[model samples]
Target: MFSKIVIACALVALCQAGFLHYHEAPIHYSAPDHFTPSQSYEAPAIHDEPAHEDHYVDEYAYPKYGYSYSVEDPHTGDHKSQHEERDGDVVKGEYSFLQPDGSFRKVTYTADHHSGFNAVVHNSPPVIHNH
Candidate 1:
């Protein structure tokens, strides 16, 4: 039993000595010769300029469509106006208006629909006055 104790003590002492030696060993490391310590960065100088007048631009300088409007009167059953739309090669529109002489004028328009287009306007003859 005494021999076993002595052997264990010797093993513990050897292990401790080896651990200490490894931790105490000096480590060597060196930076490359071409590398230099970075210096503090300095911002570049800027020159101020005088303020200028504000400029404005008109995005909608032109109208999108030629003309568009509508009117309706329930009492007289009088109504007029039209709208036109174009899709691909087809265009169509219709419009009608009541004249001051109690007459009605109607217009129809069509273009590029099945490779054909036409405009027709219907208006009554002007009333002749004997006076």
Candidate 2:
């Protein structure tokens, strides 16, 4: 009686496991007949106009505002760095580095007046910053 009961319990457990592991087939519905196929239409071809060699300027010419960076020495302990701007407003500024995991993590001085900073992390909503 004991052996029979043990075998029955084992069979029940195995059956439960199998049932839990089973996956149902995904049901996919076909598009309606009234739906028009997008590939049936063709885009108009663009014709190349004659190139104006005389109107061409040097491609390597420098612009008015140049991009540059100034790095401060860590001995001075100055956290204030150049501010990043968007549409003439300070979006982010006062950058500092935190070495939590051998990589430099950026710490920005965020203002309540702006939108927010954003950073992407796995399984979590991205970090947002506005100033």
The best candidate by lDDT is 1
How far in Å is the alpha carbon of 12 misplaced in model 1?
Answer: 99
Which stretch of 10 consecutive residues in model 1 shows the poorest summed lDDT? 58-67
The TM-score measured for candidate 1 stands at: 0.34
TM-score of each model, in listed order: 0.34, 0.19
Off by over 4 Å in 1: 1-70, 74-78, 113-117, 124-131
> How many Å off is the CA of 62 in candidate 2?
28
lDDT of 2: 0.51
Report the poorest 10 consecutive residues by lDDT, candidate 2: 118-127
Q: What residue pairs clash in candidate 1, if any at all?
A: none
Candidate 1 achieves a global lDDT of: 0.78
RMSD (CA, Å), each prediction: 27.0, 19.0
